[model samples]
Target: MRIDVHAHLWTDGYLDLLDSYGRTDTATQRGTGAGATAQELEARFELNDSAAITHQILSISPQVPHFEERAHAVHAAAYANDLYAGVVADHPDRFSAFAALPLPHVDAALTELARALDDLDMAGAAVTTDVLGASLADPAFTSLFEELDRRHAVLYVHPSGHDAGTPLIADHHMRWMVGAPMEDTIAVMHLILAGIPSRYPNVRIINSHLGGALPMLLRRADDQYQWESPQTPDKPSAAARRMWYDTVSHGHLPAIRAAAETYGPDRLLLGTDFPYQNGDLLRRAVTSIHDALPGQDATTVLDRNATALLNKA
Candidate 1:
């Protein structure tokens, strides 16, 4: 089956939930294109048929429910996860979801992870780059990672709207165009430097945006990691290959080809970043991959990789 590992579907209730949390941008964002209403889902299914996608794993990200207040975070996380659980139940064939965690609060997050997986039967968990300004590689998140390792679970890391704490980008209005990928690079590197993948080998970590400069940085790190971070357990390139990446480069064949070359074809999976790339653009996201690589390699990425990963998880 050709499954898209990176897509988002925000229900009106989910949007309303975020609004209650004081998320000011909900009005502009979260258009009907990303909603789960019958009409919107029909539009999404049409795009999927045109793109030849069999299934799409949905997630709530970039606008994740993690908050500063512990109680609020817990309520938000549970609300989002339960809502997505229902979303999956309602569309068993077309949709599955990654549960949202009340992160930066590891204990709460751990509890929610167990509930989401064991009770809600969520496919996995989704989180932003930084856990409300703390690095995921920070020792505080170690227990959560350990539990994920124990479960052999998947963890999808998307950019937090804050852009990984780079004020220059946030203040200068480079939020998505430049800041989003920068956040991806920073978050993944934090894990790489801390030996997250090497240590928690069972956890299948998926980085967004073709790993956000990882393909280009691996060689640089391989060359310098010995002196720069001798404590790192393995070569950055080697440790990086131990993880997975989604092909969501907005139909940019060169970027997709670069990521495939860096991570190998088997590690690449199809990801349309739905609603963001709807209509004709969504169709092109899949076709561009076939154009970027040889037929067999593209087929493996498009059809085989996601099924293998999800099946294992």
Candidate 2:
């Protein structure tokens, strides 16, 4: 299928829903060069065709509508899912999506997850690394994961833009530069240490940006996780292999190669953090994989892996 497992779209209606519901954080993305106009949309699609990216699995992250207000969170999530469902319906050949859930509000998230998956027929759910400040591994999120596990759904973990609650990264202006993947590293660490993968084996968890330095840190974690995180139910490496990662390290071949070496080739999927990685960078996201690995393995990563993963639904 040549599916790109990571792409993001922020429609005007989705942004308006967030703003009307009092979400001020999303305003900056309104016209950050990735416009909602038809011309820009066609340009994006044409670029996808150039890259041989037949399909794109879109998501909204770093600016998800996860306000603490129950009404606000639920409404925003429902609107986002409906909007995504419409796009997929209108362009099924080019788009599929992970549902944005109202997290830090599990029951509501559960409800919206049901609607998005069962009714809207979206691919699966996407959540930020943390809900407000709580970790995904926290027991508070277990029920949500339980339901996800039951359905054998895909859980896309994206950075929440808050920089993993770290003062150093949050205080500095490097939030998205390195902080984005830092959130990715810490969030996945929380899951590994808390046994998220082991506990909910069926939930196909996909981490962003090559699992946020995970290619480098997996062995270090495997070495020290025993005492550092004694309560972990399984080996860090074992749990990590159960999860998946996307090649979104700004098309860095070494990072991609390291990930392929650390985790098996099957664990990697093609991704371009679109708009953010648009134009030539988007094209490079695909071509770089072929450059970094053998022909057969690159083919599996670019095409076969995502087809197998998405079809698991």
Best by lDDT: 1
Model 1: per-residue Cα lDDT over 1-313, one tens digit each:
9999889877777778778877776664557488777888888888898888989998988768888888878988998888888878998899889989987888999999999999998889999989878888999999999999999999999888785577888789888878888889988888999999989999999999898888888999999999989999888999899999999899888899899999999999899888788888888889999999999999999999999999933
Total clashes for model 2: 0
Per-model TM against the reference:
0.97, 0.96
Model 2 misplacement above 4 A: 33-36
**Model 2 lDDT per residue over 1-313, tens place:** 8998888888777887888877767765777555446787799899999999999898977668788898888888887887788888878998899999987889989989998999999888999888888889889988999999999999999998886687898788878898889889999999999888988999999999999988899889989988988988888888889999999988788998999998888999999988888889999999999999999999989989999999932
Model 2, 210: alpha-carbon shift in Å? 0.4
Model 1: ten consecutive residues of lowest lDDT: 23-32
Clashing pairs in 2: none
Model 2, poorest ten-residue lDDT window?
27-36
